[model samples]
Target chain A: MLSVHSVLPSLKANATSNNMTNKINHPELCQWLKSIAIDRDKQAFTQVFRFFAPKIQRIAQSKINSEALAAEVVQDTMSNVWRKAHLFDDSKGAATTWVYTIMRNVTFDLLRKMKANKEDNLSDDIWPLAELANTEEEVFTDHIQSRNLQGIIATLPENQQQVVKGFYFMEMSQEQLAVHLDLPLGTIKSRLRLALGKLKLKLGDPHD
Target chain B: MIKHHPKFELLQGFVDGDLPASLAAGIAIHNNMCASCQQKVSQLTEQVAEASFEQSFHHKIIVNDEENLTEIAEMDFDDMINQITASDDVEPTKAIYDERSIDFKGMQYTLPSALRNIELSKTAQIGKLSRARLNLGEGEIHTSLLHIGPGGSIPEHTHKGFELTLLLAGTFADAHGQYVAGDFIMLDKRDQHQPATEHGCLCYTVANDALHFTQGINKLLNPIGAFIY
Candidate 1:
């Protein structure tokens, strides 16, 4: 069995300096989200806030033209990140893409509320959380990137290992398995169940 | 099989979150059915998301560093983090089991999940064409759920503004060719087509101006003008 360190050799190299002009580490960010969701780690949330708060503010400011509204966007978006972190599946896409989706939806709903009297909150319905993962189909072409699955499964936290085995190796219904890899549904529910309800197994190697 | 799809520009607009609610909903409906478009939207989203963060971080390094940290970002990051992390309330995650359907001309058709929540006006019929307007309050733009009965045809017409017809079910044909369910037909002032169906079809439409009929004495009178646009 390959150690997690052996599998992800670049994990350490992907760390960000204080300025963060260097390419923000996508896997590292995913690890942070996983930590926030499973451990409710405040330090992880702070790191996320430091990275995203400014970007969201500038993006919101450019779209809406109001400082107060931009602040609200940051608050609401980050709040959602904290609450919905468990729903994020790193296999679907980068952490930046997932967070950006949240920010955009918040901006759209806010714009609608400002203009119209009735608020249907159309963004969530339009981009349903489950389907958002399918858009990153390139990554799900045929499950794990042409690798030794047994080697990598050993690297995951125990709970996540069960999920990978049940989803990929077990006999699951076609309805449960969606998309090319049969993910985003049965596996998503499993991930949620593992993270939120039953086992508190740390999903990723705890964020540094 | 679906033939028509939203153009590159429209899809880009959608991923960028720049389109109006009516238009955004249309694209979403299409994406639900079109696997290729769904992949495109996701890829586009990744590209946009990457640029959004990269540009912002790079900008911070240049000039907005101190001024943004001090003046622009008036909200305290630490305070916000503290408040957010205080709540252990996780969003309950469940797969949607929506059973939303709309009936037209005595036929019941399942509504797209995207339109499951938005309100639709009472069905209004003009001969074989039935339209129920979407309740979105976008000014100057009107969105509707339009049903065309079997043997129904929209009179040949031209438009002064934009019109989008996303076929949700059944088959339709214009002067160009045949369109099946999941087809996204977006037209501007320059385009003209008279769509008809041998088998009834349901469509989600968005338009800004009344169409100008091109044939018969009704041309000047604009007989079908108020009905569609």
Candidate 2:
């Protein structure tokens, strides 16, 4: 099993910084998360909030136009982090990736609420059941696979990478992406398909 | 054994969190029954999360709002912490149960985890066909749990908008094809069919509008189909 320290050496180097450090590094943030999970450490949580709140706010703002809504997403996401901290297994995935999943789910939930006339409850629907960690070995394997996926994505051609980023991260619809890039819809569709195919080949079977 | 599954595009949309709530619910229920699709969704989720993290690493930092930060800092953190910590005792709507099996007419039918806490509004029976509508409360989509008794059949009907059905148990056959447990069937306005079951079946169905009954005696039931659905 790979340790967090081994996976992220740069982040580990910053972990020894003084407790007064305002700009908490990734490893320290992850340690703080562990503290919250294990001991409900309020001080550690405070550091996490100070580091991630603004970053999450920016992510929400980019997807949602309303400042008020963006702030709400950030608050809600952080609140969930505090509440469900025990569920966060660092062996399964990086803290940033887990937080990113939460923010994306919240943004989508808010959008659905705005679009629908009926009040839909989506608390449990945010995370897929398959993603939940049931055992330590499973968590470790998933962490390694996710890390490999990041490397494969980074190695994709620039054009494919741009389309993948715009579609997945920016939440741009295919039509919106075609219009933004001044390309035909077919081109955008094919690029996304090809990019995903290459990633699948590199990552091997999903079950493995 | 389920043969048909949701297309890759739909599953991809689900992973990206771009699918509508109704469609997502359908896929969730399907994932509960199908291990293959579950693996696929899990893979897609990891890929999306990894990519999003990389993008965040390079994203430009936004200027902080000191006033807003101060307000958040001063809020009742203790109270908020208490509520979250105490949430375990007070169950949320989505309660995890050891077993989510429904008893109907002396038979136990196990349901997918997604359908565990949903309330069934009403049950209507006509001859061999019986159905219970699952109230998803005020959405454009209508979802229901339909049960067909032995040698029963539904009236020939056409969909008004989009209709997706995930068979939970037993076997059902339409003019299109036969569907078994874990089969995901999707139909739109362009398609029409009459469905029947020899062994009886249970299905989780979602539609944009009530089914349109198109043939003979069933056509007379069309006006009331909206009510039944």
Candidate 3:
């Protein structure tokens, strides 16, 4: 089992050169999540909430323009964590990644609902696709790969990193990013492709 | 087996949660049946999560914990949980697909999970080419299930906007290429083709705008196609 105690040394070693505002590591957060899952520990839940809620809220606010909708996204995301805590498997991924997945899905769900309402013709059932059946082993492998990615992404060139941040986190399209950065569209696309290529190399061939 | 899949850029948009619902749904349906695409999506989702974490940490957004805690404390967790769980119970599509299978031309074919709740409306039919529309809801793009029987052909037509067709069963071929089960075919305004099936085929099609029939004989279908599609 990957435990907080086991990963602390490595996390600290990696933190030395980085200017991180918060020092919470994946293992510590995962431990707290396990407590909530295994024991319904409110204290653990509270800790998880205090650490993740604001970060998620910020992400939601960035992607979604509406304050009310952003708040709703955070609420729904946390409640999902609270209710579905038992479904979490630490071996599958870091607690943050799992939580982020839930938040991302919830945000998209809300956006789809908003669009559906505006259209007034789409059935709500048509939007969210059926969840894929992910086996435990597959989840574990993805978790390891995902954890490794943080360090790899950190190692990317400064220019590639900036492009990746805008593309991935801000969810900007190539055209929008080109316009925002005042760069040619081809340059934006090439930068994104280069960044993705490096990440793909570090992560290994996804097909394998 | 499937050959062509959605481009990596489109799938990237999917994992980033940035694509429109219609396109996302289309990709989701393709991912459901294509393990290769599913694996790609999984990798992209992980990449997205990692990027999000790094970005969140770099910005020092979590430093204002006290204000957020108060915000959390003031909110009703119970009510929020209830609302989420209530939506969870509203699994209409799940139940429908579990309980029902589609019957077409005396043959039973399973509906893809993404398409389970869509209600197919019968449209025009000529010879072996029969079309039925599925209203994906208001403001959302329109989709349809096109059934071309053996030796059937759809009149040569050019797309007005983007059209994505996923072959669900059997095989079909247009000027571009032959398609089998799980094949995702994307056609745009510049492309025109006559699609025909030697062994009949079932396909899920999504169109941003109505198809523009181009052949002289099928030019007559322009008005009818506009009205039905």
In terms of lDDT, which candidate is strongest? 1
Off by over 4 Å in 3: A1-24, A118-158, A169-208, B55-99, B119-126, B138-140
Which pairs clash inside model 1? none
A1-208 in candidate 3: lDDT tens per residue? 2111121222233233334443347787888877877777777877787677656766777678666777888787787777677766776656766776678678876776676543332222333322432442343345535454446666778667666766665454577557545678999889878988887666554321
Chain B TM-score of model 1, please? 0.91
Clashing pairs in 2: none
Clash totals in order? 0, 0, 4
TM-score of chain B of each: 0.91, 0.78, 0.77
TM-score of each: 0.76, 0.71, 0.74
Model 2 error, position B75 (Å)? 13
Residue ranges of candidate 2 with Cα displaced over 4 Å: A1-29, A62-64, A104-120, A125-161, A173-208, B55-106, B215-218, B224-228
Best by DockQ: 3
Per-residue lDDT over B29-122 for candidate 1, one digit per residue giving the tens place of the 0 to 100 score: 9988877678657765775676567532334222322333334644677787888888878888775566888889899998888888888889
Two-chain complex of model 3, DockQ on C-alpha atoms against the true structure: 0.21
Sort by TM-score, best first: what order? 1, 3, 2
Q: Rate the local accuracy (lDDT) of all candidates.
A: 0.73, 0.65, 0.64
Residue B157, candidate 1: C-alpha displacement in angstroms: 0.6
- In candidate 1, stretches whose alpha carbon ends up further than 4 angstroms from where it belongs are A1-21, A135-208, B55-57, B60-71, B95-97, B220-223
Q: Where does candidate 2 chain B have its weakest 10-residue lDDT segment?
A: B55-64
- Reference contact recovery of candidate 1: 0.41
lDDT of 1 at B153: 88
i-RMSD of model 1 (Å, 1 decimal): 11.6
